[model samples]
Target: MGEGGKRKSRQEEVPAPPSHRILTADELGLLKVSEVPAGDKWEETAAKQRWGLPDKAQGITRLQVHCPDWDPDRCLVAAARSSGRVTLHAGSDGGDVGSFRAAPPASTSGRSDTSTNAVQALRFSQPEGSTQLLISAATLGGHVSVHRCPVEAALATAAAGRAVHTWEEAARLQTISDLQAMDVSSSGRYLAVGGDGHQLKVWDLEVAGKAAMASTTSSAGPDGAAAAAPKAGEPLFAGKAGKPSRSGLQDLAHVTALAFVPGQDDKQVLVGTAKHKLWLYDMRAGRKPQAELVWGEGRITTLQPVADGSRIWVGNGRGHVEALDLRQAPAKLSMGHALKGVAGSIRALALHPSEPLIASVSLDRHLRVHHSTKRSSLAKLYLKQALTGVAWLPPLPAAAAAEGAKEDEEEQARAEAEEVDAAEEEEQQDAGRVARGKGKHSGRDQQAGGGSRGQHGKKKDSKRRKQ
Candidate 1:
């Protein structure tokens, strides 16, 4: 019935709905805080190509450096250089203060070979209320070594006593399966090892209440079918076989990095793969991953779970560093932009436990510090060589947290005050409106009644007189 085959409405025409889009910039007080610029040579600091090096100098083609938990004092720092020797450096004032050298791990044939081998990973275990120890592992021919913290410190204390006390080798070059990455638990109770063609293996260093390891041999079932059981009560700490954690037969795809989520009851463990996936397992539960995080096109080379288990930080071979909020669903997660120019895979990342900072090392021979929360560059150091490891100093006395009860009480009081003020203001306005409305209605009613009464009196008087 309409002009162009359009149906006519039976009711009156209605106006179109109003647009609901707001296109104005919010007037937030955005203060551009002054930033500490990277050093003028900062660009060069990240450069790997260096000239003018003596041939005999062995210009650090590959190096693995470890920074202890973000403490200001008594932090352990060590590096394995290209000269087939591991160096221990005392990190003080945010720089190297002293240095010492230890002989490389013995070869498989029980021969000490000082040939050039890359240290694949370095980890430090300083459990709460326990002494600190440094653990470093070299690749090319699996060599794992552990040294007490004081041995090097004692030598550094007495430089005149040139007799450099050698580190007590814990595990030698007996291959742990050509692993690319290793992680030591902060509690010093477990060590997670992973590498090429192997499932993640966690070694219990304190098994049976002593410093011991499981035997490195094939296990047998009752039927002698070569069951993959850890040897007896305390199996060998060699091989890819171990008592599987909650994530059974982890069977990773070329593990690239491993880390632990500390300060949690579950003590969740994270293993990253060269296939660009990360598996999160709850060690307290079973042998399967509780969750998985996948990112980027390249292998995820590093994973650093923050002090709390709710957030995770990962670096991949494609030069991407992303922050993941585990509380969100996989589809609704938060992420930061990729740190550009970061190349050759991020071999290591360390978060400052007390500060909003992160330290990262790459196979590209650069050490960069980023603000973890803002995802901004803070500082960078160029070692002119590939970096295999990194860590932040342990927490300092200045890192003490605010008193919980005091902070909670203050927040509660402020919230209560705001609520009370809002409620009182609402009550006052409501009472004023109610009073005005009552007075106006009452006056109108009185006027109406008076006019009716006057009319009625006039009519009654006139009718009576006429009667």
Candidate 2:
């Protein structure tokens, strides 16, 4: 009851009640699936739509940004629909930015691949020392398209026309079947693409960057370097996600998820397959997978490396999360702790860069975000559609992050200082006890000497009496 309590505002006096919005079954039924209508009456339009269920979320990405105008709590999510279209959604109330169709290229093999419009995967990559955001999308057809989007321009266009940049490929990495999983190296030096046809392709970034740079100089576009065929550098090497762990070497299965090990020069990768087996594929260590992590259960839907590559967060089709430590042997990888998830198969999982928060999506049409270390649920958003993929934005800056948490460095320093003081106090106490023990022993010795002298005097007195 100090100055803060005496204030008339009473803002901090009473804990603010949790604010919630109530939506009827009807209101919850329809959310705007299309563009923001003219005059922008859609906040009501979404509430009034007839269709109860919404379009499925097949793919999603968050446009990375660091600015003062943007709200730190709000996130921008772009969801790809089954209709071969991509929509930029700004949170629950953040109106749709815009939508654009991702057209597939005409097949060169004569047979037509019309499934190109169905975007199977969506990801954003920003190479080191670059400001432009590169969005890569892979469709059901063997097509991967990279779009160079500027944050200001994309959002401006999205606000003005309710549509963002028209996606044009900066570099094309064609696969045999629909690409299932793709990851760019931390350094943006390599790109790994895995697909349904058991095809694994790695693209060298230096060569691709030069190619992208040349193309940009000629046409002015942003690009992601490490994810495709050898247009300029290393030739595309093919491998498999197949074969038993003990059966020597064979091809690979349909790769469902991918993760690049984190390091300045970490070359190893963790590949999750339809067979529920995790493979450590190291290109530098020969063609065979470096190790295989198998548990013999659900298909791996998403993978996230944490604890600086020593730990990995694995989500399966069964809607469960497994925390696996890969530093152990492959057999030990099966020993993992489980985290509760959605009721259905998990489609994607995105771990926070600095925090223990992990955002995940499920076929159950919900975004379940949980704390990795605390074994607790954080937020659950029932996205109206069945979600297929999810991406979390990069970690916030130190100053912005401070709002959500106290400075860990300060805490660590205080703890260390307390430990040192405690140790010093303990040593001082031991020395004091030793000194007291010596003093007691000296007193006992003096008492013993006095007793001997008294005995001698008593004997002399008895002799004098006898005389």
Give me the candidate number with maximum TM-score.
Answer: 2
Clashing pairs in 2: 84-117, 98-162, 191-226, 240-252, 241-252, 241-253, 242-251, 242-252
Model 2 regions more than 4 Å off: 1-76, 89-93, 96-101, 106-112, 151-168, 205-235, 240-252, 264-266, 327-335, 378-384, 390-467
Q: Each candidate's lDDT (Cα)?
A: 0.52, 0.57
Judged by lDDT, which candidate is best? 2
lDDT by residue for model 1 (1-467), tens = 77544535522233221111000000121101011212222233222111122333332322333433332244434554445455444333223333333324335556554553555666555556754454544443444445555533522421233333446544432335566777667776666677888657666655521322334333334665422212323222333322344867544447777777765542556777777776666665556566665577898777777776677788888778887676653234455645544556776676665667677777665667776666668555555444555554332232121232244358779999999999999999999999999999999999999999999999999999999
Off by over 4 Å in 1: 1-75, 82-84, 92-117, 132-143, 151-166, 170-175, 208-252, 327-344, 361-367, 378-384, 387-467
- Tell me the RMSD of model 2 versus the true structure: 24.6
The digit string of per-residue lDDT tens for model 2 on 337-442 reads 6665455787666665556767676777766666678766755656565455554432234343343124334666798999999999999999999999999999
lDDT of 2: 0.57
TM-score of each: 0.54, 0.59
Worst 10 residues of 1 by lDDT: 18-27
